[model samples]
Target: MGTLYYGDAASPIEIEDRALAHVKVVIATKLRRGESFTLSWAHGEGQEPGRSTVWLHPSIPLRFAFTEAEPALLSRAWIEELATSANSSGGLMIVPEPERGGETGPR
Candidate 1:
């Protein structure tokens, strides 16, 4: 089993996977651009709160360990949801999307 971390709630927010190629791609790109953000996960049955600030960088290797690492990139759907929530709070972070035209783009 892999490690799972929760946000400020008692729900899991992070999961480890050996097959995290796509996720690593997105996260690497963001880190290359020097972006910092926070990722939260719920701990326990929605009773404990957990959170982590991800300091993205190119030097960080993409691997699954027994401890907390930098925050992983969220799925497109999650990103959209976060954007919406940020808007409601009168603030937001703009995360660029991966190129989809089958063209070689910055990694």
Candidate 2:
């Protein structure tokens, strides 16, 4: 598991390390381009069991913490999906996907 400590929230948002790593990449790209968007996810099993969304901005403090020692493989297909959403006015939604397009296969 990993936690994304974001904004004024006292509790960090929990996420899988692999997913968080991918999100980190997408978010960093948007921030670098001076864009802002929403990041949303359905709560994972064993958590609060609801959905959440965050308004991401370049000025907000953000941190990513991973439990795994070594970096997990990424999924480019997933990243493309995320990017597409980020480009839309509706913003990004962190829906689940079977990992693909990283070491698993071509993007």
For every candidate in turn, the CA RMSD to the true structure comes to 9.2, 2.8
In Å, residue 46's CA in model 1 sits off its true spot by 10
Show how many residue pairs clash in every candidate, following the order shown.
8, 0
Alpha-carbon TM-score of each model against the true structure: 0.32, 0.86
Model 1 global lDDT (CA atoms, 0 to 1): 0.39
| Tens-digit per-residue lDDT, 1-107, candidate 1 | 24433223453334444213233444444556765333333343544565343433345434433343444333555344444533343223233344333333222
lDDT of 2: 0.82
RMSD of 1: 9.2
- TM-score computed on alpha carbons, candidate 1: 0.32
Candidate 1 residues lying further than 4 Å off, grouped into runs, are: 1-26, 44-49, 64-75, 82-107
Whole-model lDDT per candidate: 0.39, 0.82
Residue 27 in candidate 1 has what lDDT? 48
lDDT for each residue of candidate 2 in 1-107, tens digit (9 for 90 to 100): 99899988987999888778778888999998988899988888987778988899999999888898778777878888888888888788876765565543211
Candidate No. with top TM-score: 2
- Winning candidate number (lDDT): 2
